[model samples]
Structure formats: C-alpha cells, structure tokens
Target: MTIFNGYEQSDREQKLNILNLPSLEAEAKKIIPTGGFGYISGGSEDEWTLHENTSAFNHIQIIPRALTNVDQPSTNTKVFGLNLKTPIMMAPAAAQGLAHSRGEKATAEGLAEVGGLMAQSTYSSTSIADTAAAGNGAPQFFQLYMSKDWEFNYSLLDEAVKAGAKGIILTVDATVDGYRESDIINNFQFPIPMANLAKFSEGDGKGKGIMEIYAAAAQKISPDDVRRIVKYTKLPVIVKGIESAEDALLAIGAGAEGIYVSNHGGRQLNGGPASIDVLHDVAKAVNHQVPVIFDSGVRRGSHVFKALASGADLVALARPIIYGLALGGAKGVSSVINHLNDELKIDMQLAGTKTIEDVKKAKILRK
Candidate 1:
C-alpha cells in the first residue's frame, strides 16, 4: 500500500495545524498530570544524554542529490521476519496508563491500524495477551527484563509465545531504575499495576509487588544470559540497550538475531553517547550480521534519514508515542506515525532515494 492510502485532506490539515511531534508533546504536557508527564518526558540525573540524543543529529548534514528519477519512494522493509510498511516502529515504553486510560492497548491498536509494529514493555500496564490481541494480526515484540527467578523469566517467555509475540527484545542496559529528578520531585507512583506481574501476586495485587522481581531480574542479566534466553525461546531474539561496538559484537556473538542500539533513551545512563553517535560504530562491528535497530533522540524525518545513512537498519520512536497517547489515545498515536511516515517519504524524495535500500546509500556529511 502507498503512504497516501487512507490519508484524507482533512487529516493533513488537522495534522499540519496541531500534530507535529513538538506540538503534540506540548499538548500532552498540558493534559497529562505533572508526575505522569515527568515520568514520560524526563531522563536520568542531569539529563545531559537526553538533550544530546536529539542534538547529535544536528552534527550530521544530509547531502541531497539532484536530477534523479524518483516518482515513488518505498518506505517498506522487512525485519524480524515481519514486512513493515515503514522503517519506523514504536519503541517499548512502560506503564502507558500514565498517559491515558487505554495505555499500551491503545498504542497497539493505533499501530496495527497504521501497519506499524510495537515492542511492548515488560512494565506495561496492559498484559501481553491483551496487547497482542489489540494488534489484530499486526506484528508485535515482547521487551523482556531478565528476572532473578529463572522460573519467572521462563514463565514470561512462555506467556509471550502463547500471546503471539513475533520476537523477543531483551533489554540489558537498565539493571536498576535511573535517577530521574522528576520522579523524585513529583513523588510519582505508577497509576496502574503492571498487568503481567500483577497476575502473579498472592492477594490485593499491586505494582509494588513486582518491584522485587524487577530488581532481581535486572541484577541477574549477563552476556551469557543472552544465550540462555535464545536457547529457551523459539522466537527470534533481539538484544536492546547496546551502545558500544564491543557490546554490539558481544550480542551478535551470543546469537542475537537483531542488535538494538539504545542508551535507554538517556533514561538509564546520564553520561552515555547518543544512540545516533554510536550507530555507525555498532553497525560496522555487527557488519551486517544482524539487523541493527536504533532508538533514542529520533525526533524528525531527517533524523530517521541520517540514522539509515549512518548504519541503522530501522528506527524506533519512544517519547513521541507517549505524547500522542496522552493527547488522543489510539488516534493520537496513529497521527504521530502517519506524520513521521509522510516526512520520511518527503525526505527520501528530496534526497533522490526511492526505497529503504537506497537510504543506506544516501550521502551524508558529519559536521
């Protein structure tokens, strides 16, 4: 299907007026509670990495080509055995109830309708089963944080498979929660219980009961654990939170089908390099052995182009999805995806590239 399919003129007018990433974020801030906004928007410690993630893109310049036949540029590509309409997919962010009543379910529905993919978070307010059901046959992946209890981890993997998850994204960066000043100042507590973990509680189940399990899982994750997870699950394994070439190589060596370059969106490490800054190095190290997925600080279509030109096979959107979720639930989320898709196509046409493969060959200059 073409990018313009089902995008009406009214939708374009509405999006032009109030649906860009920054505007949507502003709208979300006005609607979401102070604590909720803080949890979704703020990063760890001083937020140096947070600012750098987007700013790092400015250091690179796209050198567009002129006089090329580019009537139709295809954003379509395949990853993790799923054919995606665009290279962009929604990154896994936890506790969507903080933004809206529908939480992850709404996000899943929006993405599915738009033919996008979502990686559901381990701390999601909605259960994997419900989120998968919401996808309505759209592709979905399960983001897992290793649990100290091997049995618990195995149980989660079993559940994901049963729920129809297409793949497993194992996050290794956040062994412990980051030091976010917003959460400290707002005294934020999750608005809803973690749906998956809540099912395991003995009585009066709540989010607090899952803390010990989460902590244990984080502390127990290791490089060797990657192999164990791959061995245990029939689903393809994609390792997320890899920032350096060394770690990227390690993940590929450990049998990862995909290497996701992220710094936990600057939410875990205060001094980490932007995901874009490290994308080329990690991608080079992986050497096309596995698909390299990138996240953190992607704000516009130009950023998406730069990532692909640099080395990322695909890109993921994080905070922006939450912003859309806050403002309009499924509709808001779909608007964000549609806007990005539109921008990506325009950017590709301007760059004289006509497909996802051509994006890799597009010329870029680091400033």
Candidate 2:
C-alpha cells in the first residue's frame, strides 16, 4: 500500500485502505469540523446536481483497443505555455486554511512535487505571493471571482501578475452562493482571514452567511468583464462555469483564451445537467479553438480519461485534493494526486492508449 510521499504505507493508510477517492474522502471527513465538512461536501438545494456529477460518469463507457505498443505512456500535457506532468489540475476551492495550517501553500508544494498545476482561489487564505513562494516556481493560475468593486478587481489582478500567475480563471457562474441547505442547517460561516482580501475586504465574516458575503462582493459578470480581465492581466483568461456552447462562444468572442466547463461542482445550479454531460457539445462548439478544463464529478482515472476523450484538454477536482490536504497536509495532497496519476497510467494501458493524445482520441460510448 502506498501513502504520502508515494511510498511506505503508514498504519493510517493501512487501516483506512485509502486507495481510492471515496475512501480518502471518508477518512478526511472524520478529521475536519462538522460544518466545514458539510460546506465542503454539500451541494445546492436538494443536492441533485451534486449526486449527478459523479453518477453521470458511469453512463460513458470506454472501448479499449488491443495489441498496441502501449508501454511507457506519459500523462504530460502543456497548458498556457506551462509544461505539466499530468493534465489533472487542482480546481480552486476557498478557505483552504480551514482544513490545515499551511492551506494553499501546502497544496502548491504538493502539486509541485507531483507535476500538476494549482488554480489559486481569490478566497484562498494564503496570498498569491505566499502560495507562489511555496510552489517554488511551479506554474499556477489565479481564479478570479470578479468582485463588485472595480478597484478591488484591478488591484487583485495587479497582485496576481506580480506574483507570477500564468493565467487568470474568471469564474462567472457563482455571482452568489447557491441555496445550500446543508449550510443553513450547519449555520456555516468562514472562520479565518482571507489573505488576498485583506486590504479591501478582510476578517472572518463573523456574522454573515456564505451567501451574504458572496452576494455583497460578486458582480453581475458580463462578457465585457472577460475582455477587461484579459486586457488588464494580459494573461490567458479561462471563462469557467460554462454549460452551453452559446455561453462558451460568447466568452470566446469576448477574448477569453480558454473555456472551463464546470457546474461549480454542483454547488450552483442544482437542476442542471452533469458537467460531463454537457462537455462534448461545449468542446465541439469551441472546436479546438481553446483548451477545455473540466471538473464537478471526477473521482477516477477513467473519469479523467473519459473527460479527455470527450474533449477536455485537462481535468481538475477540488474535493479530493482538499480532502487529501485535510488528512495529511502537503504529502497528503501529493499522495492524492500521485494515486490518481498512477491510476491514469493503468487505465491508459488497459485501454491500449499510448499517450494523453491517444486518450483524447480513444473510443467512448455514451450509454
């Protein structure tokens, strides 16, 4: 059994049989606070979209090829001019400090160790500079939540550029928090300083709900916002939260360098189609004009492979990586990513795919 650092299983690993994402999540749940876990794990309203996110993967089936020289396959890919060892990037999640002392710093170091990228969230407890310092020169992108304040937005972008962010991820779907009942029941409230928001916005949001804080800050985002961010940052801008080809096209028309297909991990728009279900259409619409980064139901190497085959250039997930971070800090984060990549290698070999490109071209049946 492998543990953090990729070798030498500890008793925790052995006891938990922590070999898959599900088991990893189960273990991490025990250690994190009740409300924290609920906030991390729950979805909006009835949680239909959340459940659909993962379950949707089962309907897509891969037909493996036989007798290909499939030895020594690689998972390496390039995004935004950055060479990454794996296409599985970490999706941005907020308030990682609630899970561990080091938070995004630990996450960046671990991902650097594993050769993937981290999309640092605007709400991350760690600042861009500090997170970049911890990454030790790994390529990282900054996820923008387009605040209602223009000065705040410009200042945030300015800081990202100074900190060496390779790209800007403009998240558009969540202008406010979804109606997550779990949070209501738990009375969930953030309890730490948001380092990036210190100058313009700060504190633990002591008396506010997640919804209230988000509502006060998020803008009525528009395509023009995309243009402005691209112009200001002069960095590749990936428009996240796209569910339709039309929206994807709108973003592209407005100067978005990339299109990110997600449903906010089912934390927004509860009745929507699984993010995976809409990917091929959106990717088809993009028509290879830009890279597609996907998330919201990924839990397996086959899921990653399927997303690639379906059209995503890269796959990302937050719940699993953060769960890993909660359980073991940087090494835990490394362990989670390394395990998935190992599974990706095995799945590629079993499917007789020789490279990441082969996975992209491999046959898949949507049942």
Candidate RMSDs in order: 6.0, 4.9
Residue-level lDDT tens digits of model 2 in 274-336 = 999999999999999989999998999989999999999989999988888888888888888
- Provide the overall lDDT of each model, using Cα atoms, as 2-decimal numbers: 0.83, 0.86
Model 1 ranges with Cα > 4 A deviation? 1-19, 209-214
Show model 2 residue runs off by greater than 4 Å: 1-17, 202-212
Report how far residue 133 has shifted in candidate 2, in Å: 0.8
Using all chains and alpha carbons, the TM-scores for the candidates as numbered come to 0.93, 0.93
Please give the distance, in angstroms, between residue 342's alpha carbon in candidate 2 and its true position after superposition. Answer: 1.1
